[model samples]
Target: MTRSARRTRRTRRMLSVAGLGTAALLTLSACGSSDSDSDSGNDSGSASSSASADQKLTGKVTVFAAASLKESFTTLGKEFEKAHPGTEVTFNFGGSDSLAAGITGGAPADVFAAASPKTMKTVTDAGDASGDPVTFVRNQLEIATLPGNPDKVASLKDLTTNSDLKVVLCDKTVPCGGAAQKALDAGKLKLTPVSYEQDVKSALTKVELKEADAAVVYKTDVKAAGDKVEGVDFPESADAINDYPIALLKDAPNTAAAKAFIDLVRSDDGQKVLTAAGFRKP
Candidate 1:
């Protein structure tokens, strides 16, 4: 019953306590390692998801664009199709108002490029647009005369007041027509047109076919017409430059392709095509 017996028992108790402490520490370390592995797995999944989100886009993208954009947008559409193989770009080019109506009426379209913000709003207000429309270009009014400008049309007033000349104008609901009206108002002049067309292309056609002497239209249209019609810039047109806006529709069948097309329209290459078509930067 002695010092040796007490010391051996005390030493045994200390060893047992240290063994339990070491076991507890190992258990906590195992749990921490498990949690770390779980966290690492979650991060990997997230990274994979992010990578998948950027997968290659392939589909048909239908675009409802203003009639004036037919030439330039057609060029862009071809470029888009080329850039994204296996993708097709289809366009519905008409009056901005008509195009807006189509989009709001449940016509399945991926993109909308209006000649003016007002037309774009018609789609946005109806919750048809996926996001705010961005203005990519601006267009000013000009007089589209016959090839060689035989009438010697000098200004907007010449088209407005020269009763001897049969002139065509776009409908008031059309962007080009509205801008022409604004320009006319700015000049404080008024004259009835021989005919009001549904779109800029139609109005320009009247001049191109010699159906009318001159037509008020976008400079881009005149430029697109090439030798088919001569363009005459007027000072009053500066006051009525229209801002062209583009947006992806909310119910777009091809959101990815639609967004990519919008990005292209805003890109430098797209701007170059537009500027070359005689459209000004927005």
Candidate 2:
């Protein structure tokens, strides 16, 4: 064989061996890297899970409450926030029925304080409440008139006699309205208000705005109004008393905080706040 041909053949053999070595090296590197990457990914996932699990109720608490509870509950929320240094509270105050609908629709809430047991029943019936509720306070309906008894609404029947007087009451779906109905029935007086509000707070607001001469709302709600409205006591109110029920929701994220808040409410300090706001103890 010629030296040139022999050299060429030897070169080809050397190149082939080099290529095979390169390929083996690459395959071995790929195999060695798989375990490290898998372990790294698993470690990252475990860290994320541990961080989430360690998160506590020191974060946030959301409360869905009735509109009538606006003034007092705001104070209570502030006190609760102060007592729990690491926690914060956000409130959603509105009509009881609307709050119930929101809860049933999956709105996040750690606590719920309804204006009436009937409203609380809706939550319980819908399975949104975490446990059985307890009646904390009883509210009675009153005639919210002008600041000085300008109309001199002597009795429940007198309200029906004045057709020109603009009066407001809550919608039938609300607890206040239901109690008002019972009261009106007890007095044998029929009244058709100019506007049917969604809650006691709205009814009181109507009178406060001077849009109505009178409105049927809770005495506590009227008391919360300050000089904006005047509350009149009537005999019918004795017959219609609304019970307010409060509870923690089943999906509460801050369950420990929620229970603590509830306990605070049932405590003497909480009762003092409610009573000061004109809510009668149960």
The candidate maximizing TM-score is: 1
User: How do the residues 168-211 of candidate 2 rate in per-residue lDDT, one tens digit apiece?
Assistant: 98998988998899999998999998989998888888888898
In model 2, the runs with Cα more than 4 Å from the true position are: 1-57
Poorest 10 consecutive residues of model 2 by lDDT? Answer: 48-57
Residue pairs whose backbone atoms clash in candidate 2 = none
Worst 10 residues of 1 by lDDT: 45-54
TM-score per prediction, in order, is 0.81, 0.78
| Model 1 segments more than 4 A misplaced | 1-54
Look at candidate 2 and tell me the lDDT of residue 67.
86
Candidate 1 lDDT, tens digit per residue, 40-116?
85768567646644768798999999999999999999999898888999999999999999989999999999999
lDDT of each: 0.92, 0.87
Candidate with maximal lDDT? 1
